[model samples]
Target: MNVIIWNCRGASKPSFKKRVRELVQNHNPAILVVMETRVGGDRAREITNLLPFDEAIHTDATSYAGGLWVLWNADRVDITLLSSTEHEIHAKVKVRFTNVSWLLSAVYASPRNAERQILWKNLMNVAELHNLPWVIAGDFNEPLLSEDKFGGRSVSVNRSLLFKECLDKCKMLDFGFAGPRFTWTNRREVQALI
Candidate 1:
């Protein structure tokens, strides 16, 4: 099944609606996870309702900082929310016409080390909650290796170490990505990837 994870940055942008429609047409994903929506409450609800999804769940942003939405086409898969926090949303997804079921965690990790510690702990806890196949996806907000950064301060070994430990503890593997080596940039010389 196809799943699309996008850090749309802000759902309130003028082009947001058009961008989402394009993604839907191109990918035809069964599940779509949007991060850093930068909108919350009734505004978040209103915007999400306009998206072309059969169902959705969201965690509101804190005054335009961080927000998350998980949208899906019910005909493709049945999704049940297991739990949610500002940093992450855990759900049980069952594919139609198949016996396959899996746990999906969509994360919008904090840049702050302290807050990220909470995210790591929470992820570990979620890993222990079920034995089903699990997939975690999102903008982690921190690089895990030296190669993950460019045109900036060297990557912090301490930060990468903590993240590495967490992944090892959770028995999770990084599937990496395809296409460009850098997925992000400051547009002013600094380029980074994760």
Candidate 2:
């Protein structure tokens, strides 16, 4: 089943909602993970209205810093919310047609480099604890290679290596991506950003 994981940055913007709707229409994902929402309360409800998912679980923002929304098509998949935190949402998803279950971890990794290592350690612990077939995805904030960076400054090799080591230690494979080479584009013409 197709699952779409996105770090939306914020959902309050009309443009973001429109883009999300387009993505939903295009991909028709069985499960959807939206991270860094930066909005809550009525705006969250408004964001949900624009999507096709029947059921949703939300983690509210902490002072405009982070938020999470996990949406799933109830008719297609049965989802059990196992656990959640400011950085991750763990769930067990069973596809009704296949009668198969797997663990899904939706992560919004801390942008802070130091904190990211801790996040990786926690995720590794989860991996060790749960032997279930797992598919973990989100905006990890660390690119694995030079090619992974589209237009940004040279990525930190140490950060990339740490991420790679964690994945290797956990025996997880990169599912890779399709469509856009860069998930983000800095169109603002900012010098330091690029």
Which candidate number would show the highest lDDT if scored against the true structure? 1
Model 2 per-residue lDDT tens digits across residues 37-71:
98766777777866788888787777897888889
- lDDT against true structure, model 2: 0.83
Query: How well does candidate 2 match the true structure in TM-score terms?
Result: 0.85
For every candidate structure, what is the RMSD over all alpha carbons to the true structure, in angstroms? 2.1, 2.5
Please report how far candidate 2 places residue 49 from its true position, in Å: 4.9
* Top of the candidates by TM-score: 1
Clashing pairs in 1: none
* Model 1 residue 100 CA deviation in Å: 1.4
- Give the clash count for each candidate: 0, 0
The worst-scoring run of ten residues by lDDT in candidate 2 lies at 185-194
Q: What is the C-alpha lDDT of each candidate?
A: 0.89, 0.83
